[model samples]
Target: MTMLPIQTTATAPVATPVATSTGDPALPLELLELELSLDGFSGDEASFAEAVRQAADQVGGDFLFDLPASGLAEDCLRIAALRVPKGENGAPTIVFALLDAEGATIRVENPDETTKDLKRFADAFVDVLQRI
Candidate 1:
């Protein structure tokens, strides 16, 4: 099946970290999230998320897998893509946490709210997909 590319404007996605506290002794989880609406896609959120997971896997050199967490909206799906460097060269970085919701909208999130990391992920994922 042929799939069209996701269009993005020259604007930047929100990279602010929203804090989620689990009330545990450990530090809170800070997440950077961005949402994209897929107006052209006719499939449901699950299908879109699965397609994204497959696409990320096809790129190779990365770990793309599902992340089943509680408290998300029932109509949403979440996954994670982690960049695993070759050998012991560099530490692994979580590329993004992909969350697809109803109305053909997909959200890309980074646990760490660093602007640089989010920019790298957007450049790698969004730019490449836009060129497709």
Candidate 2:
């Protein structure tokens, strides 16, 4: 596994999660911040996912290619990536997605909602996203 180092500056304290109008999960502050940090490397969900997958394929290493939810938009499928942390203050994990570039699906997953698959793909090239 390749480890990408993340250094962050202090921000406002995280608030409690509230239900959204559509009843979809509300994004946590951590996930939101992660998305903001990766803005340059991100774009339309479908395009970003395809690019990441292709980049990983070119390197030809282990990549986790499972989608977390069923009924998710097929075009947007590959672009979504997430990582659930094991505890508070653990390596910052990300729940990344782009719905019409609106970020409607980025949120922490419930235990029942999670799949037996990785939340994101990993490779050394991921460093480019981090350093930028």
Error of 1 at 34 (Å): 13
The models' CA-based lDDT, in order, is: 0.40, 0.36
Q: Which residue pairs of candidate 1 clash?
A: none
Cand. 2 TM to true fold: 0.31
Give the per-residue lDDT of model 2 (tens digit) for 8-57.
33332222233222323544444434434333343444455554344333
lDDT of 1 by residue, 36-106 (tens): 22222345545765554544454333544445423332444554554433224443444444444433444
Stretch of 10 with least lDDT, candidate 2 = 12-21
The parts of candidate 1 lying over 4 Å away from their true place are 1-42, 58-61, 72-76, 84-91, 113-132
- For this target, which candidate reaches the highest lDDT against the unseen true structure? 1
